[model samples]
Target: MRTPTCGPLDLAAWLTSDSMANTTSTASEDISELIAVDEQSQDVFVSRSFPQRTGNTLRIGYGGCTTAVMIQAVCKTVQPQYQLFSFLGSFLGPTSIDHKIHCRVARTRDTRSLASRVVYAFQILENGSERVCAQASADFHVPEPALYTYSIPLPTIDGDGPEDEHHAPSARTLLSRGIEDGHITSSSANSYFTNFHLMDQYFDWRHCLTSTSTQTLLSLAPHLPTTHDSKPLTARPQIEYIRLKCRLPTPSANWAALAFYMDGGLSFLPLHLDHKSLEDAGACSTLDFALRVVETRGMDFGAWHLRERRTMAAAGGRTLSEGWVWDGEGRVVATMSQTGILRPRGEGKGRGKL
Candidate 1:
């Protein structure tokens, strides 16, 4: 297998294509960059003009909610004085592309060093029915001199190299290779299944695992450095070195991007380990997503960061999982958690109950 080069990644490229030529947006900016504040309603209207991409198919009014946009709107509502340190979001339902998401944010409490707010994202249907697509509660704090500081030891993973030399196959390339090599099979039943691979194109994931899986698709896991004497971790965490394809300028933007990236494919960690094909079991959909930014500053997306995700449990037709993001220097930047619904393919009608 040849090492794939990391190229520039533009999410807007997926949104703006020959197919979308007829589509126009008052806010033509990328999904990660658009948020309009409405003073009258004390709410924000987020534009979801980005067309949804599923595998090879591109369509409108499809795909999951735009988490980055939700996070951004919440931050924007909170304004600039305080910084986001923690947030939790519940994925109530899918948003409609035909309508702008109405975001209502409220500052519930504020103090000298800390503040808290709740954000509601909903859509009002033509029939005048209101659907709450998602909602989040966040805690923001003023940067204060810390009296204590400590970080968990970073996991030692193989294939450590200078940032430039740590390239891996792009998500598209890996999918193509998976299909060609008979490692991954295609299912036309769900557009979401098709778009799963396409979603990985937004970021670069270089696997740190050096072992073959029992299921044989090369499950993502963390491994100790070759020179380290510590035994390999018995608990398999989906570990990889990740970097965004496009650079987000501010800490808030990066937090939103992290929220977006964190929500991608996490619920499937157990399924990936179980080796059960989606045909046999099913695909997963995020129900709720949460993240805590333990460390706010000095983080750069240009460099690789270790992302370790592990399944907490799976039951009642749902799976719960948690993850941690550690910078290259061994500082833990953020922690995340999520729950998702797992519905088998070809069992029901209409987009697999996400």
Candidate 2:
């Protein structure tokens, strides 16, 4: 199919059109610089671009989340009865806001009981540098008659009964000022982060006992070096570096099944110079990012109180592999695995190869 070109203005027009609908679609225009919707045979196509530089850090607004939402949207558009079984993605490269992003979808198979598709996401840079930023393949299974049936006992929380008197905090409060802000002193916020996001979802996460301070949790995983860090430091470092290590919670039941469910939501952030670092070198630009959910479970949202996150996996002088997501649970929600012509940040891409 021919490459589609779209801009911010085009997105505005598309949003106003009656043919395009969905609250998520309406939110897309506000976050992205360009958006394109197309039809290819029985499948649909959606692409978007965002400014590369916003303030100091690379700005990737709700676009990453919107992309995931759009994939489910496409599935609903094509097959209304199908439920989202799972999703998985791998980050291939960095997406600059100065570049245009193209997303293409093609159906690989559609049968009575299952449907699968391949999605390609890439960016076209200003200097004619084109790279595949992210690639994803997904399978959506339709329920049918099976030989075996099993179910796990759902966890018990304080508000399980009719008069439990438990009230969930608003999404904004749960995300922005609470977990994302690292303010866990509030009882409601702590419960939402530790219990609601984990126990409710059937997954358990235990923080390191020594990490009782906010600084400890904030430094759980440090960002790796970007391409520009090749030079020697001219000034002495002012602050000391600290590290924290924690173990993945062991599943008491359905371990393997839960592993498969948890594996797909793992994502990582690559090291790259922030906007301030770039500006310090006398260059100002926008950075854009895209991520795909290769695998996930229905309880991901309910179990993990993920607030906000940013990730990248870059190496050498080129953008290699990366992934990012926001979870209110303060833990990794979705795992993203990427592969392409380029090698990944640390090792080769697709280490999990799920």
Best by lDDT: 1
- For every candidate in turn, the CA RMSD to the true structure comes to 10.0, 14.2
Candidate 1 structure quality by residue, lDDT tens digits, 1-354: 111122332324423345434345333334344322233345455544432433223232332335566666677756576788888877765554455666667778778778887877666555565566677888998887889788888765555532423333433343455556555554321333344543454566665533222113343211212221243322555666788766666776777667766665566666555544344454466788788888756456656777777777777888888888888778888988888777766766434234
Task: Tell me the TM-score of each prediction against the true structure.
Answer: 0.73, 0.38
Worst 10 residues of 1 by lDDT: 220-229
Model 2 misplacement above 4 A: 1-44, 48-77, 127-130, 145-217, 220-354
Error of 2 at 201 (Å): 23
* Candidate 2 lDDT over residue span 171-205, tens digit each: 22323343455543355444334422322232233
